[model samples]
Structures are given as C-alpha cells and as structure tokens.
Target: MYHSILDTSVEFIKGVGPTKADVLKKDLGLFTFRDMLAHYPFRYIDRTKFYKINQINPDSQYIQIIGRVISKKVIGDKRVKRIIAVFKDETGIMELVWFQSLKWVDTNIQVGVAYVAFGKPNLFNGTFSISHPEMELYQNRHLGRGNLTLQPVYNSTEKLKKFNLDSKGIQKLIAGLLDQVIPQVTEDLPQYILDKYQLPDKRTALLNIHFPKNQQDLNAAERRLKFEELFYIQLQLLHNKQLRQLKFKGASFELVGEKVNRFYKEFLPFELTNAQKRVVKEIRIDTQRGVQMNRLVQGDVGSGKTAVALMSMLLANDNGYQACMMAPTEILARQHYASIISLVSDDLVKVAILTGNTKKKERNILHEQLENGEIDILIGTHALIEDKVQFKNLGLVVIDEQHRFGVEQRAKLWRKNVIPPHILVMTATPIPRTLAMTLYGDLDVSVIDELPAGRKPIETRHLYEGQRLRMFGFMKQEIAKGRQVYIVYPLIKESEKLDLLHLEAGIEQLSYQFPRPDYQMSIVHGQMPNADKQFEMQQFIEGKSHIMVATTVIEVGVNVPNASVMVIENAERFGLSQLHQLRGRVGRGAEQSFCILMSGNKLSKEGRIRLETMVKTNNGFEISEIDLQLRGPGDITGTQQSGVLELKLADLASDQIILSEARNTVIALFEDDPQLDKPENSMLKAYLQKLQRGISFDKIS
Candidate 1:
C-alpha cells in the first residue's frame, strides 16, 4: 500500500501525457513514478548568484543574469543560421544566440521583458555572448546571495529535447511529481540509523536532492542516498552468505596426511612466502569447519598460487576424496596439468589430465579411471564439468580465471557430489578492495601480495613508434645471449578503423630487421589451427626460436622462463590489466628481464597513464587500483555481467570509504540481530524480503 503511489505509471502524471511518456521510457528507461524519483541530477547550479551583463567575461562559467530582450534578429545564411537577441540588464547589454529551436524560441520570446538567463559566457570578437542559454521570466525568483538555493541539472538527450523536455523541463516535471509523492514517501532507514548518522528522512532527502534549500542539506541528502544504496547491496550479499553457511554441508577433509607433507618436504621447489602461508591457513580453517568453502584466491603472476592449490588438493587426497581443477581454455588446463605434474610425484598422488584435445579412446580410459577412484586428482578445461565425467568422491574444486566461465558452469561443480565440495576460485588479476568487497561479497577473499623469493622485478620501458629500430637492436642483443623474446600485438589482422599494429604486418616488418636464419621467429595467434599453434609454441618453449611474435592470446598459459624480453606493439590500445599481464610473461626467470611498451605518439590521457603506470611500478595491486580509477568497476573483467556491482550512484573507485562504511554497518546490524528478528529491525527484514523477490543472488552463483 505504501508503494502504490510510487508504482503509478509515469503516463498518469499530469505534465507527462502518452507522447512524452513514451519519449521518457525510450530515452531514460523511466516507466513509473518510482523510476522518475530515482532519476537524480548529475549536477547542481547555484541560482542565487547573478552577474550583470557587463561583469561576465570569457572566463565566466555558467553565470545567471537578469536581463530584458530589447530586439531580436535572424543573422547569417541558411547553412550558418542563428537567431540573435540583444539582451540588456540594468548595467549593460549582451547577445543571446540560438542555433536550434529558433522557431519556438523566437516566437515565444517577448521584447522588453525582465528575464533570467543562465549559461557560460563567451567573448565573441569584441562583445560578449551566451549561446543556447536557459531563459525564464523572473516572477518571484531573486538574484541575491542571501537567498541561497541550488537548481538541479539533469542528463537529457536530443530526442527528449524535441518535445521541450531538456534538463529544465525534466526538473519541472519532477517538481510536480514530488508535490504529490513527498507526502507518501516512507523513510528508507530506521529511526535508530537516521539518528546515528544524522540523516534526514526520505521525504526531506528527496526534496533537498532536487531542490536543496542550502549546500548543507544537499550534502546530507547525497550522503543519505549513497549510504542507503550501498547498504542494501551489502545486506543482500551478507544475507545470502549467512544462509549458505546455515544450509550447506561441506565435505570434511580432516586429514592433512602423508602426500601433503611429502610434497612440501621433497616435491615443493621453493619455500612458501609468508603471504601464501597466511592464505593457506585461512583456507584450511574454512574447509575444516564442515561448512562449504566458497573462497576466492587472488595473486599476481608468478606468485605461486598453484602451490597453495596443490597443497589444498593433497588434503582431499589424504582424506580419501578426489579433487578437480577446471580452466576456461585447453591451453591453460594443459599448462596447469603440466605444472602440477612436474611438481608432484605420481607414486603417492595419481594426477591425470583431461581436455577437449583428449582422444576418444584416452577419454574413455580416463573416464573409467575417474569413476573408479583410480584418478586421485583431475585437471581439465570445461570438459571436467560435463555430465559424462563423474568423480568417485569429488571433494575439492578449483576454478582458474573464474571470470571466464558463466555462473551456471561453476555451479555444476557443486552438484558433482551429494554434498558440495570446497570451492577455490583463483584469478591472477588483482581486484581493488572496494570492488572485491562488492563483487565477491559472498565469498572469503585471500590475496597473495608477496612474490616468490629470488624473482627479480622486470624493468619496463615506454617507447614511441619512431624507436622501432632501437627496439629491434635491443631485441637482437637479448637474443644474442641465448635469451628468448616475446612480441605481442593487440590485433591479429589489419583493421581500417583502428590504427593498432596487427600481428601479420608486425611480424612481416620485424622479419626484415632480424633476418630468418639469424632470428628464427615463430608466429602465433587465435586464428591459427590448434596443432599449428602448439607446434609454434613448442619451438619457442624449447629455445629453437629466438623471437615469438603473437597476439594477446599468449597473455596467459604460456610460461617460458628463458623468454626474458617482452615487446608489446601499440601498448596504448590495451587496458592496464592486460598490459600488466603481458609484462608478467617475461619476468619468470632468474635472468634480468625487460618489457618494452611501444605506442604511437598520439595517446589519450588514460592511455598515457596506463603505459606510465606499467613503466613505474611492478605491483599488480597498484596497477589494478589505477585500472579501476580509469575504466571503473563495470569494465573490469566482466563485472558488469555478474550484476553484483550494479550500483546506482556509488562509484567503486572514489567511494571506497562509503562502501567500507556500508559494509561495516551491515555487519553490525547482523551482529546485533543475527536474523533481523529484533523488533527494531522489523522494517529492514520486511524490505529485504520484498526486494529479494525481485533479485536472485543464486543466479550469480
């Protein structure tokens, strides 16, 4: 009953009829009064301060003046047409010009009438002018500093402008709707929260956000709205997390027995870093609780996350349960299988590999071994999740690069056994803390911040396209020392629209500089046949080739320790995360490594920052923070598709403090009233129940 007024269709609003309502729906996706209410203004302009016509210079920004139009005239030819009016204030005169809506503006504008004009002033030759200024007749509005108030400026489109629905027109319609709706607006936050935060009620916030009485009220309203939006998201995430802990029973891997101890003592290559040890302990606690573990393990490239994963799986093996690791691509799965095989002795733990590349006869044998518990550990691509593949006792599931697979596919691993196994999702791309808090809110996060010992930081450099000869000379020097080189391109083929260096042309140009017999280059890309691609890759891996030129397909899964030089062509065309990953490919060996970022002279501000960031620091966390600032949360590795970061107003980059506060607030609420069963929290519980009916966190897995 409380929401019925807000749920009324926008077409029923007095100022918005069928035609205008359709326009609003198509342009802004605003269908109801509720939608219109949430359509916030992008900015606010102070209408209290007014400048005289004589005071506005070229530098004056968005000033308002009380003026009267003395005369109007049409100037210029039809192609360069405009309507110009001589507008005079008490002090002096200026020009108001309009390029569009000439007929309507010229027709309705009256002569010698007191009016208020708002726009940025420009010095047109000798005189001052304001083009397409917003004009309104001064009835009771004042232009003094004492009566301080803000006027909202909303976002609009050309389509909305056709029907006299620009920012000002939209504001007028909202004003009318607020008059009828404000009385029925219920408080979003409870009284205790409102008092603690010193927040205005929903009624005052709605009134002040659109037409703030003062700067103080506006700030309070913004805080209220931003907090509430982030608060609800954290609530849903926490609620789902709590429900899962209560409902699901996890397979207990109680025995950390012989295989794990032997792998650490004999098979393990290096001592584990302190960060990795901390993360392993965290995961151990989660698995021992007998509650299903849904944990995300984050680390940079060459951080030894695989070692942690291997040790965890050995726990399953010790407990007499099978484990599987799934990757999105066959190459990655093969790489993982090879890495694990090299690290573990097959006598204690039998490890097997399965992928799309497996032969039918071999697959049948592998399947039979898997079902009969002959396979202690299985590593594969999407083939591991297929219905035909069944495990004797699936106890642990590890997903590499979790963003590449859909939610349903990962969820399939949960059903492999009667009880869901411990889930460990790994990603080399470091996520910012704010984004991590929101996107992976339902799961526990552990970051391996420290790189392995004896690993030297790769020296990164930015070179312009004109330095191609110099780069090739450096590549020759690196290859002369028996070190391999990787040259990556953004595009596989030439694209007329983009000016990026494509692989085909890039390789052709390089072949001339470093001739065939001396250079011995191997080319790889996505378009190549799998067998051919592997053949080229093998040549590079075995040190048969001095230079491996490829596309970003070599970003992951390819780890050649001898490849000490990475040259990325058109580095500005890629984002920070991609550039960081490409840089990680070269720094695997004990030898000194270098990454050369080559770009065109012409670069966007963000592109420059990306290249500069790579050249400045080797920290993946810092690079991810900068990437979040540049590209935002939505574009960061398909977080938009997950729907968890569908924020209305909270910016994950700048609103970190607010996000943290909201999360802490939700945590406190749950701590005080674990199930929202207290009388004081009744409103929050009811709101969650209603909102949950609309959104399914389960779909996100």
Candidate 2:
C-alpha cells in the first residue's frame, strides 16, 4: 500500500498535469512520485540572510539584497535586448538586469516598489549588478514565509525550464506531492533496526529531506537514507552468495599427484614467495571442497600471480582434469603460453596455445588434442571459449586481467564443463578494500601483498623537458651497460588538442639522438600490423634492440627483464595505473631499474599528484586509493561494470566507515533469519525482490 502511493504517475500530482509530466519524464527520467523522491537536491540555499546593496562586490559569489526598484527601462533590441532596473536601499543603489524573458520581466516590474533579489554579483564599468536575479515581493520575505527558510536546489534541464520547471518549479511540485504522499510513507525497516541505528522513521526522513526543519534534521535524514541504500546492496549480494553456495556443486580434486610434485621439485624457476604459497594453498583448499570456487587473486604488477595460477593449474592436472587460461589480448595469451612452456620444460605436462593468428591446420590439431585430453593446459584468447574447443574434464579456469572480459564472455567459459569449473580471476590493477567489498563482494579475495625476495623496488624520478639532455645521457649510459630502454609516448598520432609527444615523432627524435650503427632502435604502436608489432617486441625481448619507442600498447604482456630503463615521454597525460603498468615492464631483472617521467614544466594539480604518487611508493593498493580519489569509482575500469557502484548518496569513496558498518549489520541480520522468513523481515525481503528485478548481477558469479 505504501509502495502504491509512491508509484503513482506524476501526471496525477496536483500541479504537474500531462504537459509538465511529459516534460519531466523526457528531461529528468522522473516518471512517478517515487522518482521525484529519489531525485535529491545537489545543493541548498539559505534564504534567511539578506545583504545590503552596499555590500555587493565583484568578488561576491551569490548575494541576497532587499531594495526598492527606483526606475525601470528596456535597453537594446531583438537578440541583444535586456530589461534594466535600478534598485536602491538606504546604503546604495545597484543595477538589476534580465537578459531572458525580457517582455515578461518588463511587464511585471513597478517603479518605487520594494523587492528582494538574489543572484551572483557581476561588476562591469566599475559598477555592481545582479543579472537574472530571482526576485520576489519584499512583503513575502517575512519570517515563517516559504522564502525565509532553507530552499533545496535541484537539477533540471533547459527543456524542463521551457515549461517553468527549473529548480524552483520542481521544488514547488515536490511540495504539493509531499502533502499527499508523506502521510502514506510507512517504515520499510524493522523496529529493531531503526532503534539500533538511531535512524528516523521513513515518513520523517522523506519530509525532512524535501523540507528540513533544521540543519540537524537534514543531516539525520541524509544519514538514514545513505545507510538504507548501502544496507540493501549488501543484503542482496550476501543473499545471492548464499543461494549460489547451496545450489551449485563442485568437482572434488582429492589428489596431490605426479604433475604438481614434478613442477614443485624440478621445474620451479625461483623460490616461491610466502604470499604466493599462501594463495596457492587457498586455491587448493577451495578446489578440494565439494563446492565451486570463485576467487579473485589481486597482486601488484610482477608479483608472481601467473606463477600461482600455474601451480594451481598443475594441481588440477594432477587430479585427472584439464585446465585452460583466458586473456583479453592475443599477446598476453601467447606470453602466458611461452612462460608456461618454459616452466614445465623438465616436466611431462602437455601445454598448447591457440589464438586468432594460429594456423588453421595447427588449430585443427589443437582442437583434436584438446578434445582427446592430450592437452593438459591450454592458453588462448577468446578462442578458448569457442564451441568447437571442448575440454575432456575441465576443472579449473584462470582469467588474466579479468575486468577486460564482460559477464557474457566469462559465462560462456563457465558453462564449458557440465558442473562449472573452479574459477580463478586475476588482476594486476589493485582495487581498494571498499571497492572490492562492493564490486567483487561475493567472491573470496586473496591478495599477494608482498613482492618476492631478491627483487629491488624500481627507482622512479620525475623529470621535465628542460632536463632532456641529462635524460639522454642517462639513457646512453644504461645502453652502454648492455641494458635496453623503453621510450613510451602517450599518443600514436599527434593530437591538436593535447600538446603531448606522439610515438612517431618520439621515434624520430630518439633516432636522431642515438644514430644508427651505434644504437639499435625498434618501434611499436597500435596501428602497426600484428606481425610487425610481434617482430619488434620480439627484437626488444631478445636484447637485439637497445632502445624501443612505443605507445602504451606495451603496458601489458611485454616482460623484458633486461630492459633497465623506462622513459615515459609526457607521462603526465597517463593515468596512475597506466603509468604504474608501464613502469612495471622494467625492474624484472636483478639490476636496479629506473622510471623517468618526462613532462612539461607546467602541470595541473591532478597531474602533479599522479606523478608524486608514482614517486612516493610502490604499493599498488595505496596508489589505487589515490587513483580512486582522483578518478571517481565510475571512471575506474572495473568498478562501473558492476551495477552496484551506481550509488546515489552513499559514497564508496568517502563513506567507508558507514559501508563497513552496514555490511556488518546485514551479516548479523542474516545469521538470525537466513531467508528473511520472520514477519519483521518481510519488508526487507520485498525490497530485495524489487532490487533483484531491476538488476542482473549474475555476471559477478
């Protein structure tokens, strides 16, 4: 019954008839009373203060003045027409101008009449004026009047403004609707929750949000609404998780057999970091359990994620089940294949690679081998999920850079085996704890926080254009030491808008700096043919090229341990994550590596912060927190795809404490009533059903 009241059409509201209703829907997506309630104000104005005309200055942001209109006149004609009025208080006189609705403004004005005006103050010709000020008769500005209280400033489009539906108009319409709906707004939360959280009832919250009696009321209303929003999201996620665990059965791998032992004993490339060992054990426990394992392994760049993934894959093979890995790009897939081949050289594991570039005959052979279980581990791009490539007893799947694949693509891979395979998703881009809780909250997360032993942190320095000669000398010295260099440009072609260096021009400049016969050079960019790109990358990896000039295409999958120097030209143009990934390309070997960020002398505040963050620490999680601040949650690569991040008032960026509290409360609630079968939780169950009907979060699984 309460929901029905809120779901009534806006056209049924007293002031908003059919015409205004259509405009509101077309302009702001407000179809019902519920929509209007959700459309919270972006700002509020204090209407109690009135400034004298003498206090108006050029620096004033927005001011309210009480004065009488001494004179009025129409100035200019047609397109440039405006109505000007001279308003005077006892202190001084100020000009009030209206550029829009000139005829309406001119007809409504009277000489020697008092009015209260509000607007931003503008100074021209050594005089102060208020242009397009919101004016009202001074008699209506007394205490207890509407204009004497705090006013909500809502967001509206110009199309709505055409029908007198700007912020003020919307507020008036909301006032009319509240009169009818506020009485019917019932509490959605159980009585215990309201008491425990010290939250106001639903009707009070709705009333105060649209028309707060005081600052305390506004803050309380905001807190109650934010908590409710975040709480429901947590409830839905945990509920889905519980259902998934109860419904889906997993294949049990009860053996730690030949293949894993062989790789651990002889084919191991380096001593396993304790972090890596812990993560591998976690995967082992998950696989052995009779439930499907969906885990996210997060680590910094070059933190041995692939090593852990390979060890887990070997565990699957030991139990008579084949494993497959999927990557976003062909290059990463091939790189993974090469790394796996090298790791298992002394072992008896069969590994195969399939990608778009693979020969048709070779692919046919691979298809046959894979179906017959001849391939123990297969690494490929999207080709791994093709209908023809079937696995005999697929047990585990590892997705590299998991955010690059959409939900549908991952779903296709999960459906390959009758009972879906154990899933391990990996990412080098570290996600903050709050984001991980909301974005991948359902999956069990494991972090390899520490880097491996014997690896030195990359030395990063910020350099400017004036230091070009010194940078060149340093590059020459590194090349003299038989180490390679990577010079990355932000763009492939010159952009007129951004004054950053491009890859083609960067290559030419480097060629001139170190001429042929002395320094070997290679170039790579996105526009190059795949064969050409592979050839140049392979040349750099083989140590045949001393300097490689490229774009951010090398930000991933290219692992050259011997490349001891990364020179990022115009590095300020890149995001913190991209810059960090590019820097990760180096520092893979024993010797100390350097990342020299080249930028112009002048930098924006954000650009300086990003560069400073790169110079401060090598902690990916810390960098990610700052990145989340600079670029909001929606702008981050993976967070937007998870529909949960589209929060209205509860900020994942700022409200971490509230979010944690909400999650804990929801967890405790479910402990007592798992299915929400109690009468008190019926409202919560209905709310959850509404959220489920609107969102399809199946992608997270």
In candidate 2, stretches whose alpha carbon ends up further than 4 angstroms from where it belongs are 49-149, 689-701
Task: Give me the candidate number with maximum TM-score.
Answer: 1
* Highest-scoring model, lDDT: 1
The digit string of per-residue lDDT tens for model 1 on 1-701 reads 24677778899888889999999999998888988888888888887688987788777888999989999999999898899999998799899999988777877778888789888888978889999988878864553222437888898887888788998789878888888878878776778888887888888887888888889999898888888888878988899888899999898777779998999899898999999999989988898999999999999999989999999999889888999999888778888888999998779799999988899999999999999999999999999889999999999999999989889999998999999989999999899999889888988999999988999999999999899899989998998899999999988878999977888888778878889787799999999999999899989999999999999888899889999999999999999999898898988989999999999999999999999999999999999999999998878876466677766666889988878888998999999998899887887787778666883321000
Pairs that clash in candidate 2: none
Q: How would you encode candidate 2's per-residue C-alpha lDDT over 1-701 as one tens digit per residue?
A: 23566777889888788999998888888888888887788766777777887777678887789899999998897878898999999999889998886655777778888988888998889878989887768886653324426677789876776677777778778887777777777787688888998999877887777778677899898888888878878888888777777877878889999888888998897999999999999999999888889999999999999999999998889988899999988889989988889888634799999898989999999999988989999999999888888989899999999889988889898898998899999999888888888888888999999887878999999999999999999999999999999999988888999888788787778889999989998898888999999999999989898998998888889988899999999999889988888999999999999999999999999999999999998888999899988987767664467678887677887888888988898899889999899998987787767666883321000
Global Cα lDDT for candidate 1 = 0.87
Against the true structure, candidate 1 reaches a TM-score of: 0.91
For model 1, the superposed segments whose C-alpha errors exceed 4 Å read 50-148, 691-701
lDDT of 1 at 165: 91
TM-score of each: 0.91, 0.90
lDDT of each: 0.87, 0.85
